[model samples]
Target: MSIITNIEDLRQRSKKILPRMLFDYVDGGSYDEQTLRRNETDFDALQLRQRVMVDTSGKRLGRSVLGQSYALPVGIAPTGMAGLYYPEGEVVALAAAEKWNIPYTLSTLSICSLEQLRGSTDYPFWFQLYIMKDRAFTESLIERAAAAHCSALVLTVDLPISGQRHRDIKNGLSVPLRFTGGGLFDMMLRHGWWRRQMFAKSKSFGNLAGMASAENSKLMGLAQWCASQYDPSLSWDDVAWIRKLWKGKLIAKGVLNAEDARHAIDHGCDAVIVSNHGGRQLDGARSTISSLRSVATAVNRQAPVLLDGGIRSGQDIIRALALGADLCMVGRPYLYALSAAGPAGLDTLFTILKNELEVCMALMGIRDLSEVDETCLENPRYFSREY
Candidate 1:
């Protein structure tokens, strides 16, 4: 009920409002979480070059990615079960993104279906695909996204198997929450949160409700079905197959190395997101920021390279752009903001980021995104080192 001014404030508020299981699902990372911790720490390691007494007027944050212009370079990275954080959360985030004129990516596991999202907003949003063991269902998802008029297909190449998050297992996290006595007690303590979610539009996974088997529609059943759906056999050949099926711009979302990035370009992707699934997929893999320069160098502009993971502020966004990222995507920060307030929370979060970015750009003597490059970093030598 207080003013949520920053991402940390939103995160703390989200912790207070959301149930432990739901909060952990968004906040926790896999295994030892070395990669997760490194993701943010590495950004701190890169310092921005500060310039003074320059004409900072007429500054613009707008940039185009995959041929679509945005009010800002940042996009809402897809986070599944967003509705669990707040009522109809994904829809709220999409609406906020549309109003802000930036992209909002809908996860295949999102609580809101593509159709529901399409019905809610006239703006075209990107769709993220998670290939499943059920090839037919995977194809069907692509078809559905196309029918919904998705602007791009973000094929998440990682996550052949869900990483083991300690918190999720300990908390007994499941959809349509299987409440233990402790969990119920926790929910009871947050009566306001309970009432809002209880009254909110829908709790079921909208996209998978019809496709999921009856047995898979229950609490733990959904988890089991989701785990079983991940196909370990997924390969580059599958990406080619998907390319043949999808006519829109294709973006491979989990590239961490140059070889993989090159594969994405060779397979005809329009962009490659240098990401590690926010360190949720691989625990000890190098941070996305650390890998950005090498992957960007390899791709050599064959396709635009975007970075996702540990992007918490506009300063971080600028650092990514300096390190060779064409754009950036944020996941947890926006979710925390949405959970803290709602649509208004998102509006505030975007405003804060935009303002911070503008201020940073002005300080760097840069007036536009095109002016941002490796030269904007205080220490470009760190980025020049071989990965």
Candidate 2:
């Protein structure tokens, strides 16, 4: 209703509009949420070096990641059940990314099917794959991504098994949403969200629709099916198998340490995303930004290193770039913006991030992304500290 100028504003608005379960699913992390809290706090710990008496003309934010050009050095990270944020949320976010000329990754668990998203726009979007217990199903998903003309395959390596998210358990969160009386009451209170989402285009998990039988499509049943599908036996061998199957650029997401980063490269990945699944898994693990410097050093520029987790603003993106990240991905911030005001909120969010990045660059006496490096940072000790 009032002026929504920042990501935090969008977050608050999303809290007000979304049901508690859906909101918690996006907002909360695993166990004690230590990693989740650290992700943002560590960014605050890093201060930028400001320079005044220099030319700040002809600033450029455009960047190329894994052979694709982007208007910004950021991409929309894959988020599951984005439709729960708003009706057809994935499609809306993809549309926004298309308008901005940035990549939008479709999650394997996304509500919109790959075909649906591909049909929505001519631009090629990346596809994120989760290796399930069923190898046949996993291979099928890879084949489907190729059929959909996905330019890249983001293999999420961290989630061999889902983390124990306390909020999700307490709220009884599920794909279709297990509605309790309290949950129903919460939804009733958010009348606008209810009206919009109830009549929304798709309610079931779009990608998994044909795979799941009608009985397994129910709220609790779908949760059970999903739980049973996650293969704890998933390993580097699977990544190798996927690489052999997929001809496009392969990005290994969820690389938090040097060993994993090296393994990602060894398995023929084009890029390694230094992430902890937004702290949704491994709650005690180090934040993505805190691990970026070390991972980047280990990789030694063998492959481009991308980062995701607690990136709320353009200044955060700059911090990641300074720490050795080639590109940054955002998840919750854009979801909150989309939930707050649909596609328009995403447009505003992008505008705010780009403006902030430009302003920060100018203050640092830097005009382009290439000019950003460790020199723009203030505390060297922070980067050296082991997480």
Candidate 3:
């Protein structure tokens, strides 16, 4: 096996180890994936101003979000059915995050239940919600999160309707995985992944236990479930309704504009995660980084502003900090690590990123994350224009 030193290494390994359907679910974005490509490219366009001759002995990569202290600012972003990456991947992911003193967000569509995960980790984590058309079910989920001791409620506002991820349809990705002749061949090639998946105790969406009991539930699938559940009428007014039910910290995810960012604050969101759903929705939309500065400016420290999408490395995390993001939520990178390797892979990924981030900061003469502002960039004034 090759010595893994970076996220790309893990990604390549994951691609080889997992089946095509599962790998594509983690890797491929929606439609043409223009915004997906742009997410990374936009971050690459921004350059850091390397500084020299400064004290660098006491740099610590730490931050507090929602009254919780993290050893690093990067937290696991919610991914649907994360357990498919490895056997009980979400459980392992949470355990790893707890070990590192970071956060793990459980997706509404997770294969592990909040109650189950609550027992696995010592510390509390965040929960991501997609307001269902069934308000009763939505309220039940909120109640369940509270019961699970989830610290914050991450209200995902972007996905009013499901985006057409071309890969999913092409791969015929579904739960219980109907295998084509080629798929069977592919599975034979990747027996290790198949074996792990077969042994997974609660693979049928643990969060949605008893929700799909029919014999053909696997063919019915989560996407179809999402289509049926997601309320298209989800508006800012719904935030008030949710706010009434959830007293914990509320973070509005998927805000791409300043108006919406500020409006999230207006609707009593504790934080705003600037995302385009990792470019899995709105394929032609602006990259999260491109829109991040404006959203950050709009929130203006009234609430924490975070960025998600295309954060493949610690250098990318540094780019986000310079662009005015308070914290960054990582999706694909963690999944890559968890899927490629096991618990150790996740820990190694975190270590590599930590080293990269600190080195990047130290080279730029930054001793703390607090010092990481717009000044750290070559074009600090690039975001000076009105939104």
- lDDT string for model 1 (145-253, tens) is 9999999999999989889999999998877677798888887888768888888787877778755465355635555777778988899999999999999999999
Superpose all Cα atoms of candidate 2 onto the true structure and report the RMSD in Å to 1 decimal. Answer: 1.6
Model 2 misses residue 292 by how many Å?
A: 0.2
The CA lDDT of each predicted structure is: 0.88, 0.89, 0.87
Better of 1 and 2 by lDDT: 2
Pairs of residues clashing in candidate 1? none
The global Cα lDDT (0 to 1) of model 2 is 0.89
Report backbone clashes per prediction. 0, 0, 0
Candidate 2 steric clashes:
0
Candidate 2: list runs displaced more than 4 Å.
Answer: 214-219, 385-387
Candidate maximizing lDDT? 2
TM-score, structure 2 vs. true? 0.97
- RMSD (Å) per prediction: 1.6, 1.6, 1.9
Give candidate 3's error at residue 275 in angstroms. 0.5
Better of 2 and 3 by lDDT: 2
TM-score of each: 0.97, 0.97, 0.96
